[model samples]
Each structure stands twice: as C-alpha cells, then as structure tokens.
Target: MLAKSFALAALASAAFASPLVVPVSGGDTPPADQVTISGITTSGTGCPQGSVGQFLSADRETFTLIFDSYQAQIGPGTVPTDARKFCQINLNLHYPQGFQYSIMKTIFRGYASLQKGVSGTQQATYYFSGESAQCSTKSTFTGPVTKDYTVEDDLTVASTVWSPCGADLPHQYQVPDHA
Candidate 1:
C-alpha cells in the first residue's frame, strides 16, 4: 500500500511539472460583431478578441504579461436589441504557473464593419478562472504566434444595416509607435 501511494505521488508531481499548451488559431479571433476593449477605459480593441498567443504557464519567466480577450458584435447598430436576451461568453485559460489570475471585461460598441452599420457603446461582462504562472521570462516565438482558447456567448443574431457610412473597430488610435 505504501509503495502504491508513493507511485501516485510521483505521477501527480510529474503531471504538475508539465505546462499546459493551448493550441490556438480560429477561435481566438472574435467575430465581427463582438467588441474587445480594455478594463479601465473603452480604448483600443483590447487584445485579439480570441487570439491565444502563448501558454500562460504556472511558471512565468517575466513580470509583465499579455492576454487576449474574446468578444462578438451583432445587430443593425452593434447594440444587442435585447440586453437580457443578449450574448454571454466565459473565457478560461490555464497557464503552467499555478494560481496567477488576470481579469477581462468586455467593451460593447456600435460601428460599421465595411459590411454593415451600427453605432453605440455598451459594457459586456464575464468572469474567467485561469491557472497561475510557471515561467519567469516571456516565451520566445518567431513569426505570428498562435494558440487555442474557448469562449461562451449568447448564440443570437441581430439585424444590421447593410451599409455603414464610417465603420471601424476599436483601435488604440494612438499617435505613433515609439522606437
């Protein structure tokens, strides 16, 4: 019995040592309708609505980190016709690091997609439960990085104006990139 217990412990330790690699792509990018903004202010289109760039391991090699929030925009003006019966998506990520937490809030806005027109701003909300850090430094990557993630939103479609005069997504709209 003691030997069996020891074996289980060893297996658990080995499993814990492994970092969770989320294979990302398709799902990370939010649909045209949903909006992705920041926490404090409704600034740029915060992170790729659903783009998972890398693993949020329990061990992070660096202090600062980057994360992407997922979202979707829909309707004739971008505002969900009905808030109560609108959309809801829950995003959860697991880093190899253990117990670190990040928060994501949705910034709903109205705009025209070259395809449709809608204009308004609303705040969508959700809660995510993800694992903590495991590495200290940021993982290095070449070319466009990709990873997989999950999202939950009310699966309802809203009508939108076929033509928008001036439609645009939320962008940092900053002046210039510092060298």
Candidate 2:
C-alpha cells in the first residue's frame, strides 16, 4: 500500500477538481452544460513527471486521474521519501455566466498498508490561483492495518468557501511539499 503517494486522478484530478468544486449562484445550480474543464496540471514529490494524468467522462460530469508511481512504504531499508508523497493538481475551468462554484465535498480513495505505531494522511487544499482565501480537508489513517480506503472531506454549507466568478482561475488541490 502506498500511503501518501500524491498523484491522484482517480486519486481524482478533475474528479478531484470537479470532485473539488461545483458551480452555483443565487441558490441555483450552475449550468452543468456550460461548465467545462479547460486544463489540468500536477506537480509534487508525490507525483514525478508522467506519473499522473486526468480523464474526463463523456457527459463531462466526471473525470479520473491514474497514478502509476504514486505510492509510499516505510520499513527497514525504505528511504524517508517512501513514507509520504503528495501531488498538487490544478484544474482550470470555464464557468457559465453569472455563476461560481463551491466545493461541497471531495472524496479521495486509495490503497493503504500500515504497521502498528505508524499512520498515514491524505489532504487536499482548494484555492483559486492568486487568491489568498482557501478551503482545505484532510483524512488520517492510523497503523496496524492494510486495505483500501476512501477519505471524504465534507464541508458544511456555512463553512464552504466558493470559487469567485468572472475570472479564469485554476482550482488547485495540494498537500504542501513540507507537510
């Protein structure tokens, strides 16, 4: 099990990105048809070049990212870097007129294996490019286990921070390199 191997497409890039934000305004759902992902890019120690990428479904409501080398392991002989890895993914999206979005929730699914006394963590931070305000979520795994996992960050309506409209912004998800 790779603990925090950072690259995530099914590990949800746009899924994580879309999985990260949904457009809305005036209590109306943003036109799904008008919202489309324009671009996506990822970088991190958890995601070296070519180790991550994204795929969008035909209906445009869903997408997944596949990571080949994003994994973490810790034991004798394992390097320090094996214990944690992270990918920062940016999704540039076009929104409908007069509409903006908020990340109500995000689901991160992954494989994990841990020995007693150790723990794992996966985190995502959502923010618009060049903006100081942001929203973040985190999930933690304690050791003495090995299995698949799904971590969801569900934000309360009051707590949800929305993406501002009228500008081309890249929705960014990340675990800071030092974290």
Candidate 3:
C-alpha cells in the first residue's frame, strides 16, 4: 500500500554482496552443498513480463533484479491500482541433499515521498511450492516525509517456515492475490 510511490530504487539492493552460508549449531562446521538458482519467474503489475531485468553473479551466491516500470502513485486522477503494487518473485533454488533452510529475516529497501497523513505499506510472502507452511512480513510508513528507507522483518525460528530437506518441487515466493 504505497500512497506515493518510489521511482528509481528497488525492493532489494541491486545485488546481495554476501554469500549464503549454512552453519550448524554451536558454531560447528556444516557440510557444503551446491546451491544454485535454476530459474526464476515474475508475475505482477509491478513486474510484468519483460519488465524485470535479472543478473546472477558468476559464483551464483547472489543475484540482482532491476525494474523498468515498477512504481506506484496516488492522489487526484490516480487509479486505485496505482496506489498499490505487487511484485512477486519466485526463485527456484537447488540445494544438495539434507540441505534445509528457513527465512529468518527479510529486508525491504526503497525511497518514498508521501504527503502528510498518507501511509504506505510493503509486504512480502514467502512460501515454497508444494510446501504447506508459509511466512510473511510487512512494513508500514506514515507520511509527511521524503527519504530513503530500509525495513527489516525478522521471522523467529518457531515462526519461520523451513524448506523441505530434500524435496523435488521448486520453492517459490508466495504471490499475493493482486498478482
């Protein structure tokens, strides 16, 4: 729910600079597994076909998404849909056997310029296809401000949804109804 939209920034940084490392409890070492992004798909008004540009680092540890037309706006003459936007990203990650993981946190980044009394919200739903459990996080911003913002939502261990240890089905981001 973005009352006044962002123009240039993205939901995530241009790329994640760090690699994902799986560790055992007590700081013990964990086995290594080859994790890769087999494919990705996007479907939403904010990320229609061909609107998103993707890039994966050579090491495959991180990726980047650039949006050409993802935005939102409000006030007179703006349609209802213009006030809200949804961009669902479904990532197909391949993990080795016995590899299990959960989304402990989610961070959203962007810039907004909202007038007084206007409020905007950003939401993300995480779920793997064929998995019953799902997790979501949301951030709300009250206006009378104009600045860049970074919001983080952490999912506790018990509240997080873990991926199937050795499942064949692909894990994807849960898209909202609007998408």
Candidate 4:
C-alpha cells in the first residue's frame, strides 16, 4: 500500500508540470514598434539585513529602463551618483512559434549610474502584461505563438560604498535551552 501511494503522488505531480505562458486571443502579430518594459526593483536573494517587502524607491535615487532601441523612464528623477555602481538588470524570454514547438530564448543586459557614486551590473526581465493592436492583422491560421516573459532584478555593485568603520562580520552561537 505504501509503494502504491508513493507512485500515485509522483503521477499527480508530473501531470501538473507545465511552463508559464501568456496567450494572445484573436489572431495578432508582434508590433513593428519596440516594446516598452518597466518595473520596480526587488531584492534578489542576498539582500542586506532589514530590507524586505519594500518596493525599490525613487527617493534619493533614479531609475531607468533601457531596451534594444530606446531608453525609458522607470522611476522619478535621477539615480544618485554614489548609488549607480550597484545597479544591474537582466531578462529571460521564451518564444514558441507553433503550439508545441519551442523557438528561442534570449537574454538582455542593462546598466545604471547613481549620484551617490554606487554603480553595478543588474539583470532585468520583461513580462507581457498587456498588448495593443497598433495595426490590424490579416490571418487566423498563421500559427500558435507562445511567449513567456519574466524580468530578473539582478544588480551588482559598480563601486563600493565605503563605511567609516571597515567590514563588520557576524558570528553565530547557540545557547542551551533551560526548558
């Protein structure tokens, strides 16, 4: 019975394995005009202590979005000169020409400069939140197109923020419980 239960669980999990995709209804083709992408920065993995659940702020900082052809505004104002060294962006894209066949995956890079003297490389990803028909389409049986868009917020330090007191390392210790 235990063996049978384990097999059943495995089957159920496999049945639900699928990649994320956004389907465009009615038949439409990608626009000739460039797509504009924008998003707020979120801490990826190794974030400093005390900064979680907060959206990237424009205060004392500036944000911009750069794509293949154009650079657009993401946040208000300018990035501080000192903080520019630590910003980075990257992207992961999936495109399928037909319903079942995979076409390609592409990666793009972005850079930023800050007023506070901080600069860095970052990864940015794009998502197809919405699409508009700037022009009309002429075919229906063209092909099954699938696109999965996701932006990665991967920024690294361009320059280091100097602390008056050198690096402070942390030491972890365990104490015996009285209970």
RMSD of candidates 1 onward, in order: 23.7, 3.9, 4.2, 25.7
Give the per-residue lDDT of model 2 (tens digit) for 25-71.
45666666777877778888777789876787776665677776676
Estimate TM-scores for all models: 0.20, 0.80, 0.77, 0.16
Off by over 4 Å in 1: 1-85, 104-109, 112-121, 129-179
Could you give the candidate ranking by lDDT, starting with the highest?
Answer: 2, 3, 1, 4
Expressed as tens digits, the lDDT of each residue in 43-147 for candidate 3 is: 787778998788777766556666676666677667778766777787676666555655555555667777787777767787778777888776666777788
Query: Residue 154 CA error for candidate 2 (Å)?
Result: 2.1
Model 2 earns a TM-score of 0.80
Task: Kindly report which residue stretches of model 2 are placed more than 4 angstroms away from their true locations once superposed.
Answer: 1-10, 13-15, 19-27, 176-179
Q: What is the lDDT of residue 56 in candidate 4?
A: 21
- Number of colliding residue pairs in model 1: 48
Please rank every candidate by TM-score, starting with the best: 2, 3, 1, 4
Deviation from native of the Cα of residue 33 in model 3, angstroms: 6.1
Model 4: lDDT equals 0.20
What C-alpha lDDT values do all the predictions have?
A: 0.21, 0.65, 0.61, 0.20
TM-score winner between 1 and 4, please give it.
Answer: 1
Q: What TM-score, to 2 decimals, does candidate 4 have?
A: 0.16
